[model samples]
Target: MRPRLLLVTDLGYPAAGRTYRDEDIDLAARLRADFAVAMCHPLDAAPLMAGFDLVLVRNSGPVLHYAEQYAEFRRVALESGTRVFSQLSGRADMAGKQYLLDLTAAGYPVIPTVDRVEDVGSLPDVPEYVVKPKLGADSVGLRFVPRAELGAVTGQLIQPRVPFRYEVSFYFVDHTFQYALHAPDPGRRWDLVPYEPTAADLAFAQRFVDWNTVDHGIQRVDACRTEDGDLLLVELEDLNPFLSLDRVPPGTRDAFVAALTAALLRMLA
Candidate 1:
């Protein structure tokens, strides 16, 4: 008998220029070849999860919108010892934005981040600072404040507003690099195209992937190329990061699906 798989996602999520429904629909169709697949919203995951052998979270939308329910889901999953892909132990975005401050303090190539007002001096003296909630996602509660007004800010992470040339995201399935995509125009972040990464770019992205140390599930390393020709971490999306599979070439998309299928099989093993 095929193992039962519960795929969790929010199909109706109104992503700016992308469709979560189509992507998950395509993904589920592909996965059905290997497992008895069922789909559910993040809200329904906990109740439905026990009936399945594994729960794969994808495009579930920002947990902030359903904080209590998400927390409960996590708690139940952990307490029940139910297997979760990307495993619940991810220290990056899956946890929160705190990894920004940690990575910055550890001197990783991430945008300088400071959670406390007293630490503003640690960042570059940019005219404005980007502030957002630690638990926020999809830019919710994100704002920019002038350098002069930064001292008055509270209860959020802060970083210099980096003026970058472009944003690139490296997608990985279970620690292996799959492919990359980039937004040539910073103003339209979702307008992504295939990006060919140089060796150094792969190394830079791989460093974070190694740091994350998740042995299963998918991850996207989002970084921005600065004017000085350096890449800095923008986000490490380990929790339900959108694959943007529609943007990649057909061959690349096939390889990605193959990789994900193998990873899921390994987890089930």
Candidate 2:
């Protein structure tokens, strides 16, 4: 029998610069050729996971929208040993934005980030700083404040407003590099095109992928090119990362699907 797959997602989620439904629908159609697939909203994932061989969390929308439900799903999945793709061991976005602060403190190339008022003074003095809820995603709850106004907010993270040239995303499947896409215009974040990464670029992206705990599932390493041509980590998305597969060449897209299918088979085995 084909593996029974429970794909969790929210078709109606109003994600910025991306359509959650179209992507998930396209993925489900592809996976159907290899598995018995059923789809449901993230809120409903907890109860239904028991009946499936694997729970693939794709574009489930921000878990912040259903914190209680998401927490319950975690508890049940962990207690029941329900195999979840992008397993709960992820220390990045799957947990929260706290990883940014941790990476910054550890001297990683991430934009300097701090969550406490006491540490705000340590960051380089930029004219404007960014503040976002520690649990925020999709730029939700992100705000800008003058440098002098730092430490005035609580339960928020602070980072300098980077004057980066452009943003790029490196996609991976189980530590294997796939294709890349990037926004040439920094102002038009979603206006993306195919990007060809240099050997150095691949190494830079792979470093974080290596640092992450996921031995399965997709990962996207998002970064920005600073004015001085340095790359600073924007975010590490290990959970429900939007592949933007529609933007890649047909051959690359096919390769990604094959890799994903093999990963799932290995997982089930």
- Residue 58 alpha-carbon offset, candidate 2, angstroms: 0.3
* Model 2: per-residue Cα lDDT over 1-269, one tens digit each: 88999999999998888898998898899999999999999989998999999999999987888889999999999999999998888999999998998899888899999988788788888899999988888888999999878758788998989899999999998899988899999998888899999998899899999999999888999999999998899999998898888888888888888899899888898
Model 2 residue pairs with clashes? none
Instruction: Report the C-alpha lDDT of model 1 over 1-269, residue by residue, as the tens digit.
Output: 88899999999999888899999999999899898999999999998899989999999999999999999999999999998987888999889999999999899999999999998988899998999999998888999999999878888999999999999999999899999999999999989999999999999999999999588879999999999999999999999999999999999999999999889889988
The CA-based lDDT of model 2 is what? 0.91
Against the reference, the lDDT scores of all candidates come to 0.93, 0.91
Question: For candidate 1, what is the TM-score?
Answer: 0.98
